[model samples]
Target chain A: MPNNALLLDGTKVAESIKETLKERIQALGEKGIVPCLATVLVGSDPSSATYVRMKGNACRRLGIGSRRVVLPENTTTEELVETIRELNEDPAVHGILLQHPVPASIDEREAFEAISIEKDVDGVTTLGYARTAFGLADFPSCTPAAILAIMKHYRIEAEGKHAVVIGRSPILGKPVSAMLLNENATVTTCHSRTRGLPDLVRLADIVVAAVGRPRFVQGDWLKPGAVVLDAGYNPGNVGDVDYEACLGKASAITPVPAGVGPVTIATLLKHTVEAAEKYGNR
Target chain B: MPNNALLLDGTKVAESIKETLKERIQALGEKGIVPCLATVLVGSDPSSATYVRMKGNACRRLGIGSRRVVLPENTTTEELVETIRELNEDPAVHGILLQHPVPASIDEREAFEAISIEKDVDGVTTLGYARTAFGLADFPSCTPAAILAIMKHYRIEAEGKHAVVIGRSPILGKPVSAMLLNENATVTTCHSRTRGLPDLVRLADIVVAAVGRPRFVQGDWLKPGAVVLDAGYNPGNVGDVDYEACLGKASAITPVPAGVGPVTIATLLKHTVEAAEKYGNR
Candidate 1:
C-alpha cells in the first residue's frame, strides 16, 4: 500500500447501504409489498448470466423478490418489447432490468424504452436518462449513482472542484458528469476522441475513470491530491486506472474488486425497494 | 468591429436555414399538410408576447400555420397541463411551444412534460432533452442546436478540441456541451460555483458563454485563436462575452444582436416544420 494514500473501500460502504436497505425491506414486508426486480436476459452469454445471478442473489440476501426471464438468441425487437410490456403491467414487479447487449438482432434501446418510466428502476429509459441528467431523477443509473454515494460517504466535496470524467457512455460517463455538474462541480468529460487526455486529467481535483479500458489511465497522469474513482471492470479484474502507479500519487483511490462494482448492485437493490414503496402507495 | 475577429453571422445563417425550410414547407403544403406551431403563453408578459408574435410571423412567412394559446396569469398547474394535453391531442397542431416562466406557482416541468414527446418541437421535454443529450434527437433545444449549426457553417472543428462551456442551464449550456461531446470534443462545463474560471477558460480551444451575465467572461481569459460563441442575452443587449475586448483576441466571435438569438428562433421554426411533416405522415 502506498503511504498517505487513502483507500475508498466501496465494499464496506455498499454493505452499510445494504444494511439500511434490509430495514427498509423489512418495513416494506410488513406493509405487504415485497419489492420485486425482474431481470430479462435475451441470450445465455456467460458474463451476462453471471451479472443476472449476482443481482438475483443480492435481492435474495436482502429479502427482496427477484424473477428471471430467459429468452432465446433469435428474439426479435417486437418480441422483446412485448416481454417488457408484460413485466411493466405486473403489479408485483417494481423494477425491470433488461440485461444489455441483448442479442445483435434486437434493438436494445427500444427494449430499454419499453419499460414503463415508473418501473424504470434500472434507469435505462431515455426519459430516466434525461431526468437524471437534469437532476430530476428519483433513481439514476446504478454505477454513476453509486459513485456519487461513495463520494458522499467519504465527505468528498464536489462544490467548486474540477472533476475529470473519462467516458461518455449513456449509463456511466454521461450521467455521472451531469450529476457532478448538479453538485456545483466544474466537470470535464473526455473520451477516446479527446485530445491530450493526460493534460486534462492532470488538472482535475477529482478523476473518474469509466472508459472500460484496462488500466488506460496512467498513474502519473493523476494530480498529487486528486480523488480517484475507477468504474471500469475490464478483464483480469483490472480497472481503468493503473492502480500500482497511481497508488503513491492519489489522495484516495478505489480498488477494482471492492470499488464501484459492489456499490452498483447495492444501489440497484436500494432503488428497487424505493420503487416498490412508491408503487404500494399508488 | 474588433480587429482580426471573424463575426459568426447568425442572421445570414438563420436566413439560409429558413430559405431551405420554405421549400420543405411548400412540399408539405402540396401534400395538404400545413405545418403548424402552437405557442402557449401563460401571461401577458411583453417579452413572451413578442416571442409568440415573432413565431407567428415566421410561420406565416413560410406558409406554415401558427396558433397562440394565451392563458390568464392565475392559471393553475392543473389548468396549464390540461391545456397542453388538449394541444397534444389536437391532430392539426404539429408542434407545441409553451413559453417558459409561466408563473411561480405553476409547475413549469409538469407543464413542459405534458407536451407529447412527438410534438415537442421546442425540445423542452425530458425525453427530448435526453434524446438530444444522447445524440439521437430529431429536434433539440433550438438555441443549442443553432449553436452547432453556426459551428458547422463556419467549419469550426470540434473533434479532439477543448471546449469550455460556462454555464449549466438545461436549455443552452448543458445541451451545447453534450452536443460538443457527441462531436468528440473534450468538454469542460463551468458554472457559478466554478473556481479559477479564467484559468480554465485560457486553456480552451472553443469558449461558449451561456452564463446569462453581461460580460461575465473577460476578453483576456480567452486563448488566442479560440472560437467564441456567446449565448447570453442580458439587458441592454450585452452578451456573456466581453465582445469588444475579446474581438481582437479570438479567431471568431458572435455579435449579440445577430448572434445566437436570431438563429434560435430560426431553428425553432425549422423543427416545427419538420414536426409537421412527421405528423402528416402519421
Candidate 2:
C-alpha cells in the first residue's frame, strides 16, 4: 500500500497565520489601536477554564490584550447578559467570547445574542449566524472559519468536491456546511441520527469528522486519497476519526492534537484584530 | 429500456391530505372554530397575485376563511411592518402568509419577523427557522414540510440514508437538511457553487432538487431505486430534476406540476388548522 496519509501540518499553517496577524496587530498598535479580547466564564468548568486561559495566553504572545471576567457557577442569565452588555460598551474590548457550554441555568443563545455583532469576534451572535448562513461577507464562527482557512492554505479545492461533515452541532455542522456551500463545495452533514455512516464516508473526497466520537470513522471506510480533517477533541486527545486506520487510505489527514485545534485560536486572534480595525475606524 | 420514470404521484397524495384536512375543518367548524388565513401581498407582481389567489381559492373550498391585504409596490418597510403587526394582533386570523420576494425596498426579513410565531402559518419567522433548524417540533416552511409529509405518506425510510439535496436556499436547503438530520438521514446540500454535481448525485439514495434550475439533475446520475423529490418550481412549470432521464432509475419521483406544488398548499392549510386550535385554547 502506498503511504497515502500525507500529514496535514496544521501547526505550521497556524504559525504562518499568526505571523501575518502579528504584523497587523503591530500596525494597529502603532496607530494607538489596541486589539483586545474579553473572555467571560460563568462557571468553573475545567475544560472551559483551560480553553479561556489558552486564549488569553495566545493573546499575550501575539502582543494583544485580554480581559478575563470570571463569574460564579450559579450566575443567572440576566447577570450574564449584563456583563456582555458592559463589554459591548467598553472601548477597549474589541472582541467578546463567552465560553461555550455555559451553566445550564443560563440561556446561552440569549447571552450570545447580547454580544454586539461589532464585538463578536467569536461570531456567536444571532446577526453573525444570519450573516454567515446568508453568505454575507461577515465574521464566521472561529472554528468553521479556521477550517476554511486551513483548506485554503493547503490549496484544497472545495468547489464541486463532496465534503462529508460528520457532525450537526450548530457551531460546527450547520455553520460549516453553510460556509462550505458559500465556497462552492457540495456539503453533506451527518450526525448521531444519521444512517449508513461507512457508506457515506467511502463516497467522500474530503471527510470532516466533528461528531466528537473517538475513532468513529474507521480507516477501511475512507475513500482512498481522501483528505481528512478530524475536528473531534475528545479526552486523551483522540479524534473522531481512527487515524491509525486512515494511515494508508487518506491522501492527507490532520492529526488529533496539532491539527484543527491550533488554527481555531489563530482565527480567533485574527478576528480580534479585524474587530479592532473596524471598530477603531469608527 | 424500461420507462424507469416512476411518476411520484404528488397530486394524488395532496388530494388525500386535502380530504383529511377538509374533515378536520368540518369538525372544527362544528365547535365554532373556523380556520382563517391572513394573506399579505406587498406588491402587484403577477406571480405573487396568482399565488395568493390560489391560496384564497383553496381556503374557500376547504371552508377556511381568508383576509387579503394588498399594499402598493412602493410601500415603505415600516408601513409593511405595521400592516403585518396588525394582522399578527388580529385574533380572527389563525394563520399569516406573506407572499415572498417582496419589492426590493421592503426589508423582507424584518417583515417576516413581525408575524407572531403562533400565527406564522407560512413558517418564515425567526422562531420557525430556529425551531426547524434545531429540530424542534414546530411548523416548518410549507414546501419542505410537504416534502417530509409526502415521504411519511409513502413510508419511505430515511434513517441512515444518504440524501443529496441540491440547493441551499434558506426556506428549502438549510431547513430541509435539518429536518432530514432529525429523521436520521445523512444529508448533503449542493448549490450553484457546489463542485462535482454528478458525483454527489450518484451517491444519494434519496435526491432532492430545489435549485430553481429546470431539469438540472440528469437521470444517469441517480442511484438505482433512489427516491427523488423535485421541489423546484421554475418558469414554464418545470422541475429541477430531469424527469425524462430519471424515469427508470428512480423507484419514486414527484412530478413537476402536481408533485410538491399541491402538497405545499395542503400543508399550509394544515398549519392553518393547527394555528386555529392553538389560538382557540389560548
Candidate 3:
C-alpha cells in the first residue's frame, strides 16, 4: 500500500466553507434578511425526496428559511413552470431548486428555463450554465462548484494539468470540465461512447470519474500519483472509482459518502446566501 | 514526399450547402418574403469593414437581402445594443449578424445578449451559446458550424474519435468542442495555458487549430493520417497550421483560402434562410 496517498476530506472543506457562510448568514439576520431556498419536487421518487429533504435541512442548519413545494407525479410541464414562475416572483425566495429527473411526461427543460436567473441558485437554467462556461457565472451548478471548492481548499493547482473527465452530463461532467479548463487545465471530456477508456485514463494528471457506476474505474486505470475525484453516486455508498483499488495509485482521493455529496449541499446553501446578500445590497 | 493527402475542400462543401439554400430562398421569395440578414458593426476597423462587405456580397449572390447598420467607432454599448434591438424587432430582418470584437470600451457580451434569440442568426448571444453546448441551438455560431459542415461533407465519423480542439475562444474553439462531444467524439480542449500542446495534438484523430497564430502547428505535432482542420485565419492568407510542414503527416487537411472561411459565410446564409422559413411557416 502506497499509504502516502492523502485523503481529500470533502467534509472538512464543507465545514470550513459553512463556517464562513454562517457569519454571513448572521450578518444578514442583523439586517432583517433571512436567506431562503425553495425546493420543488415533481414526483415522489423516494431518493429525490430524501435529497430535497437533506438540502432543506442543511439550509435550516445555516439559519436559512426552507420552503418545500411538492407536486404530484402527473404534474404537467405548464403547471410546473407556472409554479416556478410564482416562486420567481416571490420576494421571500432567495434561491429555487427543482429536483432533477422530473416525470417523463413533463418538459423538464422548459420548467428549468422558466426559473428566473437571479433566483436560480441551483444553476439548473441554461443561462447559468452558459455563464459558467464563459467564466462569468455568479452561481454555477452546486456539484461542480463543490468539486472546485474541494480543490481550492486543498490548494490543488489546475494550471497546465491534463484533466480527464469521464462523463458528459450537462450539469456535472460538462460544467466541471469547463470550470477546470477556465482554471487552465487541459480538459478532456469523455462519455460512454469513447473508445479505450482505460487507455485514456492512464494519461490523466487529474481523473474525474462521473460515469455514475459503482467502482467502474479500477486502480489500473489511474496513472501513478494521479489525483482522483469520484463524482459518481452509486448505490451502497460506492463511488465510480474503486476507492480501495485507486488508493495505491492516486496521490489524493475523495471518499464517496463524505466526498462530493456533502460539499454539494453546502455549496447550494452558499449560493442561496450569496443570492440573499445581493438582494440585501439592493 | 507523400503528396497524396486529400484536401478537405471547404469551398466545394460550401457550394453544395448554398445550392440547397438557393431553392429555399426562392421558395420564400414566392411567398413575398426576402430572407434578410441585418449586420451591425460597432466600429470602423478595416478588417471588420471588409468582413461585412464579404458577407453582404455572399448574401446578394444567394438572393438574400443584406442590411448594414454601421455605428461610429466611439459608440457606447447601450447604443450598440439599441441598434441590435431595433433590428431584432424589425419584421424585414429574419436574421441578425453582429460583427465581433466591438470596441474595448463596450460590454460586447451585454450587447450580444440584447439581440433577440429568434433573429440571432450569428448565434453570439449567451442563450444561443448554451443551446449550442446542449446540442439544441436553432442557429449555432457560424465558424463552428462551418467546421462540422466540412466534417459531415467528408463523412468523417466523430464517434469514438479523439478530437483535440486547440483553442478555447467562446465562439470558435469552445463551441466546436461541445459540438464534437455531442457527436460522441472524446474532445480535449487546449489553449495557450496548456502544457505539451504538440504531444496532445499527436494523439488526436482529428485536430482543429483555432489558436489564431500563423502556422503555429507544425507537422511534427500531428500524427500521420490525422485529419487537420485549420480554422485560424491569419494575415496574408496563412492559417494556424504550417501547411507545407503538415502536408506529409495529415491524411486530410483544409487549405486556408478555400477552407473554413467560405464554409462559414455559407453557414450564415443557411441559418438566415432557416429563420426565414420558420417565419414564413408561421
Leading candidate by TM-score: 3
Model 2 alpha-carbon miss at residue A227, Å:
2.1
Per-residue lDDT of model 3, residues A1-282, tens digit only: 476578899899999989999889999999989988999998899999999999999988889999999999999999999999999889889999999989999998899999999988988888899999999998999899998899999999999999999998888999999999999999999899999899889989999999999999999999999999989898888899999999988999999989989899999999999999997533
* lDDT (C-alpha, whole model) for all candidates: 0.91, 0.86, 0.92
Write the number of the candidate with greater lDDT, choosing between 1 and 2. Answer: 1
- Model 1: lDDT of residue A226: 93
User: Could you estimate the TM-score for every candidate?
Assistant: 0.97, 0.83, 0.98
Candidate 3, residue B149: lDDT: 95
Candidate 1 RMSD computed on C-alpha atoms after optimal superposition onto the true structure:
1.7
List candidate 3 stretches off by more than 4 Å.
A280-282, B1-3, B280-282
Model 1 Cα lDDT, one tens digit per residue, A194-252: 88999899999999999999999998898898999999998889999999888899999
Ordered list by DockQ, greatest first: 1, 3, 2
Model 1: runs farther than 4 Å from truth? B1-3
Interface RMSD of each: 0.6, 2.5, 0.5
Query: Model 1 over residues B54-98: C-alpha lDDT tens digits?
Result: 888888887888988999999999999999999888888998999
Task: Please name the candidate that would achieve the greatest DockQ relative to the true structure.
Answer: 1
Scored against the true structure, residue A215 in model 1 reaches a CA lDDT of: 93
Ranking by TM-score: 3, 1, 2
